[model samples]
Target chain A: GAGVSQSPSNKVTEKGKDVELRCDPISGHTALYWYRQRLGQGLEFLIYFQGNSAPDKSGLPSDRFSAERTGESVSTLTIQRTQQEDSAVYLCASSPRGGTGANSPLHFGNGTRLTVT
Target chain B: AQSVAQPEDQVNVAEGNPLTVKCTYSVSGNPYLFWYVQYPNRGLQFLLKYITGDNLVKGSYGFEAEFNKSQTSFHLKKPSALVSDSALYFCAVTSGNTPLVFGKGTRLSVIA
Candidate 1:
């Protein structure tokens, strides 16, 4: 894809139900990231993946939230049991490279608006 | 640790007036600063960044940001405001191998 792609632009689920959000990063991008944005709030980092190394799960809000990325391709964010507080827009972004000094600009997807009822 | 602060929740300006959005950051080492804009029902679009070199960095859509090391500020500026420029603006910062940290977004409304 020319840009980052996310599946199911919108999802509404009942409390306690599990939900999975998928992201397809841009081809050749080695770094992928997931973020959550609450209504009228700033983005909150959820997880990050760089190449084949272990993902950085430091930002995951709770154990119920986990993500997996296969190599440098598709990634999935799964919320074990949804709650009303879990309602937010889940965004995916990709960058060509990853590191501190790297000047890799992130390209974002349209994001999935998750609503937990 | 890295963090970003966008003090103002909203900014209003006339179409022809100049516009500015304030941002401040905290990082251990040299900071990588970025500005992104979000439109209604659309994804975030990159505006500009400051890594090194000149303090004044130019970016897309005739937008520019000044990296002030002393004040820990990277303020976004535009010569003239346009109605089309009205959107949600975000300031982000990162250092070393840490993940990007973003501040609460600021809403810019340019009245035409």
Candidate 2:
């Protein structure tokens, strides 16, 4: 794809339901990231995947928020037993190189807006 | 821990006038700073980055950012403003190989 792509641009789920968001990064990009954006807050880092290495789950807000990536391609973010506070935009970004180094800017997807009712 | 700050929640500028969006960051080691823009119903687009050397770095769409290590600031600037440039701007920072930490976005509104 010419740019990063995400599925179901908007989602509204009931509280306590599980929701999954998908992300397809640009071809050949080795690094991917997930972030959460609240109604009026900044983008909050959720998780990061670099190649086959263990993903950096340090940013996950809680155990309910989990993500998985296959190889260096598609990735999915799952929020189990979603709560009203989980309502936010889930963003996915990919870069040709890892987070470090110059000239490696992240290309982002339009993001999935998750709303918990 | 690494963090970035975009002080102004909104900035208003007239078309054809120079514009600036302020940013500041804090990190342990050498800071790698970045700027990104988000348009309505669109994803964030990378503007520029500052890694090392030349304090002034040029980026897409005729945008530029200056890295000030002493003040720990990386402010985005444009020689002229365009109404189309109105969007949400974000500043981010990363140290070593950590995930990028972003700041609360600043909304830029350029009046025609």
Candidate 3:
């Protein structure tokens, strides 16, 4: 319960449907991240939220992908009109904001395995 | 910009034998290297990290990684392999306040 937690550990949806994945980061952690891992591929950064500042959506592959973190607590990643290519394990990680001193590694959750059929 | 590379896609080692999983990095400044393992249908589990200090850093599950600045590598090592240790291993690197960049990952299969 102390580590990051993600909802809907496994999701199966029809293509072109919208889906939202939720992430509950560790309490007191200000930085939350989203990543996607396709079969046989590395984890790809999706979006990041650091405290109250604007989220960095540079890693988002397309406009259909977006995320929001409310008050440094919980975050949601939404994929609009998901395609088969969107099938992958969506991972969530959390860490303390800033450099690697007191805040070193990012703790990850079990992740949501999204399968778009 | 920072990047990590795991040259081998898979590693095979017999139980009780020493194991090495190679990892290389490309970063602008001092690299913050980390190793994580993933079991089937599971998230990445933290193994160990190299921030500064020592070149050889010990991590969880009897694993260690050697940070070689000159070679730009942070290869994971274990004195003795275990069958339970078989999993997908990833190497990650970060520079500045950027997000962690991960390698493709190497599947370690320890045979009994």
Candidate 4:
């Protein structure tokens, strides 16, 4: 609908396998973000795409985690060779502006619950 | 650099009683603070925000937050509690060009 949409509501993957999570941000939104939430924990910022600007990959845990956004449209987060520690809920959010607007609160998707075993 | 902290891991309140979830932040410049609630198996829902204007901001679901600059605090409050309010609440902050940093979240359980 109008809100951000994420695919594969739940995923179970064997260790050492690869998985790709998709996110469809709200139409016309300039900022798209990805975050990881561990069980009963807080959100860990993964990455964010603002328009055509180079995405901020500072929050990525390691080389195994990466993401891509196509012209502010759909985005994909790929975890290569996932490990048991990679299990968590991956959330996607979108906002009208990047990080400077007073009215740019993020709209989030239900998120993908990933299980690595 | 910007950061947020939710001191309490959980808060329990009786129905019809006032409730508060404490939050504190540290930012280099003016802080953009926000509150979000997460229900069971759901994504985070925006509650309210404090950007610049008023210190007290009203938001969805009969919730309000007070931004105290001097104290570096933005605490969420509600006059009366509802059992439906029992969920995980997260506090977040952003400053300048920094991405939003979230707190470890506080669970609010409103008993009936």
Candidate 5:
């Protein structure tokens, strides 16, 4: 209730399969972000949505990675033809607002561990 | 573009001793710096942030960070260390409307 929430904490899939990870941001939050974290690696930015509009999408590793948001409430990240390299923990975060980067601390979800075999 | 750097991959500090985790940033204009901690099997928890004014900002769990304007650095410090404090610490920065960009992370080990 006090933070962001993500569904299906652990997801395991075989290679070439498709998976959908969901993120339910904090109520009333307007900025949401999607990131991927490989084992022993830093967080890799995926996409950012501000009020259903994504201004920067260059972080997507490939065209296989896609994400969408609706009315600033929920966001879904879809990975198609997933490969073994896609195995990692996917994280989601939200803030009160976007654009200025000041006075806004991102609240994060526990993350969804995605394992592609 | 804004970026954060955590030079150390791992930091080892003895219990009861003070600890420091270094961070630096590069941004086009003013930089917003933050520190977050991740315990085992837990989501990243925000520790503190440096927005403006205060050079030293206190945060949860007795952690504090100093923002140095000239050095362009925001280093996290604690007067004393605890074993439970051992975790993965990340430094992040945000400028303009871009999403917060994180550093590679520094694994802090507070040995008891």
Candidate 6:
């Protein structure tokens, strides 16, 4: 089966510009998660969506970050007025189920490298 | 608050020697622990997980992790290291329905 896929492997944007990163989760995956990986820092959770219900936006760092998942499938993470601090690799992962107890491994996609100049 | 700690910034070992990367966690109740590996220019790859009923869990690429409830530790280990095993390793923990909290990754360098 195809793993999770994200588009625009690399994107360079000017500061204050908006950029949208897309993620296509595996077929039938009920859960999707977004994370940011900055150099010398661990992966930071961004947002999560499960089964089309209200997404968990708690991990979003700021109001400039927002994400939308449609029908438990494709998801888009947008950053408005991108900043140089936002430069990092945005990773998307999917799992078959929710809850922290589930052993279903998270399948990750090759992340989008967003560089804000 | 739930958290994870990877004390070692880097671990170097000779190929064919045993290797271990230490991780400790703090969380209320039980902990859902996982180990992931990342090669250059790649996304994290799940290596193994320890949920319950087992202290020693084996995972992909001949990697294994031992869960120690008393010490609040889940240390990744391998019997024999290979040069290809060199990469960044992460330890993560989640309690209940919360999202995974990752530790500062440990870079493993296996010298052949």
TM-score each candidate.
0.98, 0.97, 0.96, 0.97, 0.95, 0.97
* Candidate 1: tens digits of C-alpha lDDT, residues B22-87: 999999988999999998778999899898899999998889999999999999999999999999
Tens digits of per-residue lDDT for model 4, A11-45: 99999999999999999898999999999789999
Local distance difference test scores for all models: 0.92, 0.92, 0.90, 0.92, 0.89, 0.92
Which wins on DockQ, candidate 1 or candidate 5?
Answer: 1
Q: How many backbone collisions does model 2 have?
A: 0
Model 3 lDDT per residue over A1-117, tens place: 588999999999999999999999999988888999999999999888888888888899999999989898999999999999999999999987673212468889999999999
* Model 1's TM-score against the true structure: 0.98
Candidate 3 vs 5: which has more lDDT: 3
Using Cα atoms, each model's DockQ against the true complex is 0.69, 0.69, 0.59, 0.67, 0.67, 0.69
Off by over 4 Å in 4: A98-102
TM-score of chain B of 4: 0.98
Docking class of 5: medium
Which residues of candidate 5, in runs, are more than 4 Å off?
Answer: A99-101
lDDT of 4 by residue, B1-112 (tens): 7788899998999999999999999999888899999998888999999888999999999999999999999999999999999999999998858778999999999999
Which candidate achieves the best TM-score against the true structure? 1
Kept native contacts, fraction for each prediction? 0.72, 0.70, 0.56, 0.64, 0.62, 0.64
**DockQ score of the complex predicted as candidate 6:** 0.69
Q: Model 2: clashing residue pairs?
A: none
Residue-by-residue lDDT tens digits, candidate 1, A1-117: 478999999999999999999999999988999999999899999999999888889989999999999999999999988999999999999988764314887889999999999
Candidate 2, residue A58: lDDT: 94
- Candidate 4 backbone collisions, by pair: none
> In model 6, which runs have C-alpha deviations exceeding 4 angstroms?
A99-101
Which regions of candidate 1 deviate over 4 angstroms?
A99-102
Docking class of 3: medium
After TM-score superposition, the amount by which residue B84's alpha carbon in candidate 5 deviates from its true location, in angstroms, is: 1.5
